[model samples]
Target: MMEKHVQEFAFMKCLPALTLAAAMATVGTMIPVASQADTSPHSGPAQATASTQYPVPTFEGEWAIMAMDPVKVAGNRALGPAARLLVTLPDSLQKIVGQNHFSLSRQSGSAWQGKQDDLTVTFKLVSENSAELHISGKENHKLDLPLYRNN
Candidate 1:
């Protein structure tokens, strides 16, 4: 029949467009599901419990400068020999690094955080005997140190 033939021809002409519309609809539905999966706790920018997950090292000892010697100077001359950090644990959390003293607040993972006056000091442990310390002063200064444990 001619009518049947015309209907078949119209369907053939619209076949590609129908297939594309179906594909677009499927993708649109999947987009929301995919976004939800990204926001889930199992993946993507989740809160780090790195402190609990990793073993935190102690911050009770002396740390000596391994690099950036001249930059740590407080006055006209370098505080040679005396140019080291002495951290007394627990109670006072007293720190004697250069002419500044910081009170320890938290020691988590490979990091140590403290306060000196209004400034914050952070120490990122490099190894069991080495760490990188950043002291917030007039200008934030960093020191890469190799610690020599005294007991």
Candidate 2:
């Protein structure tokens, strides 16, 4: 009777294993395999395109100096000066006038003068988004400050 009881317990365990294997086989056969050639329309390479050009601003006006700073000149003990210029462009570039204001100073023994005035201010528009101002009037010498379009 003990041998019969042991055999019955072993059979019960085997039955569960058989059922699990059958269930996995059924699931595997029901699922479909995918192919590699399925291409999506939005997955293609982006086309090459040209960027739009921005309009340039006209440089013609009476500008005042806003601020100035000293910059190190390459290989020179003296520092280069930078100024913030306010300018109003004229209808013609030939009749342009501007002002430059700088906050730059040179070393005690350095041969540099920081200055900003009417004679030192010069303005030029490089592009619609940028402009260049040259200042050379006071203790500070030449400066080139890039200006962006306010709009």
Candidate 3:
């Protein structure tokens, strides 16, 4: 019984300190990290980095992967050459590429290229409506997909 009383006394004395520490932690989280980070101007080239702009291709936009079986589209012989080419792409090229996003840094008429994360992304406009999306990633993994202009 006496040990219990001593234990309670110790806890009572520590409670205020624990509450203060918890309150400090709460206040720390309430403050935005951006407001706390040092924003003062540095003495060197780091400031110039803010102005370095990445070139954006004029055709930078999302494209979709076209799932086509040449045998299915075979019946539609009347399809235009460009449309036909998109549909008849070899199975060797068919791929399930996630996120049909394109941000080509460089462009030349129908061709475009850009680096997205670790993947090299490229596209070729087949028509005003259709495009080809190609992404090459680490270990030479490549993806070829058909796309339709989303906008």
Candidate 4:
């Protein structure tokens, strides 16, 4: 009787191992062949497609000036100040803004340029939401202002 009981216990233990092995085999065979297809050749265009997720900036509404620092001239004179700008991205435009549409070019490093009528402004980022704005080339002459996002 003891021998029969020992055999039954061994069989029960083996049942769990058999079940586990069968489960693994089932899962291994279930893998979709399409998922394992060579994706490397298609990866470059896929990455390029992902980059297009961001949209470009356009002239639509009000964007604020964040910061402004003078860009030193060759002879210690101040040709202009660096500036940064921010625009409260409208719900309609948020998707495009994610691609860095509000960003502009400046005469110096990391500085952005803005224009209003006859005025052209230069700016640099002090933070993600703030910038230093330098306004010139108009009757306003020169102005430094802090621009902030609405939300």
Residue lDDT tens for model 2, 16-97: 8999999989988998766575368766432222232211113223332334222112122332343222333323322232
For model 2, the local distance difference test gives: 0.41
Among all candidates shown, the one with the greatest lDDT: 3
For lDDT, candidate 2 versus 3, the one ahead is 3
> Which structure is stronger by TM-score: 1 or 4?
1
Better of 3 and 4 by TM-score: 3
Predictions: Cα RMSD each = 14.7, 19.1, 17.2, 16.9
Candidate 1 regions exceeding 4 Å error are 1-49, 52-57, 66-98, 139-151
Which whole-number lDDT from 0 to 100 does residue 55 have in model 2?
18
Instruction: Determine the backbone clash count of candidate 3.
Output: 0
Candidate order (TM-score): 1, 3, 4, 2
Model 3 residue 111 distance off true place after TM-score fit, in angstroms: 1.7
> Evaluated with TM-score, which candidate comes out highest?
1
TM-scores of all predicted structures: 0.36, 0.25, 0.34, 0.28
| Poorly placed runs, candidate 4 (over 4 Å) | 1-109, 114-118, 138-140
Worst 10 residues of 3 by lDDT: 70-79
Q: What's the best-to-worst order under lDDT?
A: 3, 1, 4, 2
Tell me the lDDT of model 3 at 67. 57
Writing each residue's lDDT as its tens digit, candidate 4 over 20-64 gives 999999998998655564567644222112122211121212344
